[model samples]
Target: MSSAGEAPSELTGAFIEIAKVTDLGATGESETVVGNTTADVSISKDQTNSETNKHSQRRSVRTKTYNTLDIEVPALLVPGASQLETMGVVDSDGEEIYGDVWDACRIHIYDKEPATASSPAQTFEFENVEWDWSEISLPEDYGEISFTGWVHGAWRRGKTATS
Candidate 1:
């Protein structure tokens, strides 16, 4: 309703966003965190570009803030899977990390079971699984993403004492 004569229309669609991982450990080629219906992975690699001289170039890593960036992830109707809601920056110690240029990439998967599980619970089921990675947007600050307040409870069991 409006003062004079106006009408508001309803919108339908899921909300998604991309966040830059501000911090992460300086070492390790890849890291993955599995959830009930989603899995987030981050890959680190050395980067060299003409814009930045070889010595001046810095190391960069690809990290997913959330396993499922899809708001309607569950609506996808995949069985034996849940929806991923949030994602945070990776924990980096501010060291020289490297990966293949352009070719190398990190992928987020929505597996049926959690990756931390000893083994896949069942042989196979109608677990809805989908994956996609948003582009990385680095910030001006420098620091490895610490798991200080990061949420790791996307699974039934809770975050491990040490990530």
Candidate 2:
């Protein structure tokens, strides 16, 4: 188990991947395969805190607001590429075209260097996920694209690696 003042194992060589819920067969069952194409991945859970003060006493409560997932991958040039295409965008006629906008998907993060045995991986199931925004940067070395989305409803299952 984890406790305060202990630093968990760092996710140095972790990876992230996403798959459309519809990709699953009629039974809606599939295995999570982490993508190696993505260069970076970030996941965060945000909450709204409300504090009540009553006559020199203070009370506070926290409510889960939403979760956000950001993925950065190399811009694909091939037609109907795998990673970018699955993210609701496809290369059409030498132009980027939007594909299915509203689709449910699952995002998986696998921590290769877990702090403990229990912190192996985490999965977040998002419903009604749509493309929020993306950015392309032209640097001296190479070009990269980042995609961000707002998860309507998210369910997370995992355990933090403990010391």
Candidate 3:
């Protein structure tokens, strides 16, 4: 709540990057998306938990910190590029001989300006991530390529050091 008559502030200038590599390496036209979720939860919510259901005023401790963010991903490995290209399995015609799987994926979250020599920008870095594209339901609804990410590690929130 805002103090007295103070206006409620909003946060902006935040961005996210999705990559096929743990280091977040890729190149191409940044993919753009328009995300619209009618309703959802960022983390796991188990209502039967004794602590949250009975002890914590209907708040679940299991969902206190989300290892995920729902920001627009902004882009992918460029249009017309196959998953094999993303996995570095492209052939002469840029085709994958076989499907590939990821061992480790990375996501870099920057709420403020990216790392610079002078100022420390606020950022969130997910070391290892597992992500997938959601299936689109047909006929009655518009088709969509939904991106869902699962981050694994401590909740790291701090200023980014200058590179």
lDDT of 2 by residue, 1-163 (tens): 1122221222123554555565332344544332332234444444455555566656654554543433233332222245444544555333455434444555555666333325336654555556543454323332345555455543334322222
- Which whole-number lDDT from 0 to 100 does residue 21 have in model 3? 38
lDDT of 1 by residue, 1-163 (tens): 1132211111122221112121122233232322222212222122233332355558554453333211122212111111111232222443222211111111233223333444332211111122232332233342112111112212111111223
lDDT string for model 3 (35-119, tens) is 2222221322112322345574766454333223322232332333343245333445754333233433333334443343233
- Provide the global lDDT of candidate 1 against the true structure: 0.23
Error of 1 at 88 (Å): 3.8
Q: Ten-residue segment with the worst summed lDDT in candidate 3? A: 1-10
Shift of residue 38 alpha carbon in model 3, Å: 20
Candidate RMSDs in Å, in order, are 20.6, 8.5, 11.3
**What number of backbone clashes does candidate 2 have, counting pairs of residues 3 or more apart or in separate chains?**
0
lDDT of each: 0.23, 0.42, 0.33
Worst window of 10 by summed lDDT in candidate 2: 1-10
* Error at 145, model 1, angstroms: 22
Query: Which ranges in model 2 have alpha carbons more than 4 Å from their true place?
Result: 1-13, 23-40, 45-82, 91-94, 98-102, 113-120, 137-144, 158-163
Tell me the deviation in Å of residue 150 in model 2: 0.9
**Where does model 1 exceed 4 Å of error?**
1-27, 38-72, 75-86, 89-117, 121-163
Give me the candidate number with maximum lDDT: 2
**Residue pair clashes in candidate 2:** none
